[model samples]
Target: MYKILIVEDQEKIRNELGELLRRYGYEVVIIEEFENVLEDIKKAEAHLILLDINLPVYDGYYICKEIRQTLDTPIIIVTSRDSDMDELMSMNLGADDFVTKPYNTQILLARISVLLKRAYAGYQEVVQFNNFKINFSKGILINDGQEVELTKNEMKILACLTKDKGCIVSREDLVSYLWDSEWFVDDNTLTVNINRLRKKFESIGVENVIQTKRGQGYFIE
Candidate 1:
């Protein structure tokens, strides 16, 4: 099933949308913490998002911009604002579609279904080399049918390497991917994350899953 996230602060709207989407066989998550919208989005791992304009801490535009930096998931602005500028701004901020409030339930569901099918109809979830099962939507990793605890950095590194298995990822690229912004992170931090990932692999009986090239980079073989 495809996962969907609804980022509206109003309890009634959030619950109604979630229930409607769930009835259509979609795994839906409603955003509870408005202050940490981006973090909640990452945790939901949703294929598509229905975001509202007015929020408590930050507006939907800010969240959309932040999400675009790392993820390519579809975002549909579902707001009460029907102004042309509002629609244009959302599109400019990487929103895939826009729907104003008081929308017809059927039409909203149709838009959602079309976007979900277009984005994920044939896409398969990625599987790591060492029998580590990662549910990108839930941000959970499973090893031997049990959940494996991983730091956020570890998950990001593993996702990057496993997504490009057998390809050497340069240190610069790895650092950029992990940091996501122009923040300076020590080289030793990357090394630590890699070591932690190696231990996880070792725990699952997979030796040398991630190979290093002295001055080049690392790759999952």
Candidate 2:
């Protein structure tokens, strides 16, 4: 699922946009805090951002430029500012698209779909989970400034467990998933991989990321 972040200050509009995006099968993150908007954006790890120009502290233009300095995440300026300068400035500051308020719902959705496809086509996905940045394509788990690589089986195991956050994934189910991926692993081998995954996280100062529900299975809480 693609994560979309809404960086609008208005509560009503923010909630409305979140609901609109969620209804279309997109993971929506609504940013309410403007004090540290930049840090908040980074932590959200959104594939696309719906940014507003009129903000509390630093306006959207400044934030957009700063983000372009590092990230290539798709940014769509969804603001009430409908001036020629506003649109031009947004494009100049690395916004992928610009939409004025009172936008047609279908048009907005289409813009989001097209931009997400363009930005993430053949792109490696990275997601943030519990203080860890997981890059499934690269098979790497990063914490703070440290990173550890995972083997094929280990990566699959982590992916399975994290697919449903805070929920116990049965060992049988995990084995089946690995088998489907042609990894042919037994229960004992699964245990070994789980232990190895824990050790790798421990090596990066991340402990107990994967929790076991003894009689059931394993989970990340």
Candidate 1 segments exceeding 4 Å error: 121-142, 147-208, 212-218
lDDT for each residue of candidate 2 in 139-203, tens digit (9 for 90 to 100) = 57899999876544565677777777898998888877655432434457667678878999999
RMSD (CA, angstroms), candidate 2: 14.0
Among residues 3 or more apart in sequence or in different chains, the pairs in candidate 1 whose N, CA or C atoms overlap within 3 Å are none
Tell how far residue 23 is off in model 1, in angstroms: 0.8
Mark the regions of model 2 whose C-alpha exceeds 4 Å error after superposition. 123-221
Q: Which 10-residue window in model 2 sums to the lowest lDDT?
A: 178-187
For candidate 1, the per-residue lDDT at 9 reads: 91
Question: What would the TM-score be for candidate 2 when compared with the true structure?
Answer: 0.59
Write the residue-wise lDDT of candidate 1 on 132-160 in tens digits.
Answer: 67654344567777654444456567777
* Model 2: how far residue 125 lies from native, Å: 9.5
The candidate scoring highest on lDDT is 2
Cα lDDT, model 1, residue 185: 59
Backbone clash pairs for candidate 2 read none
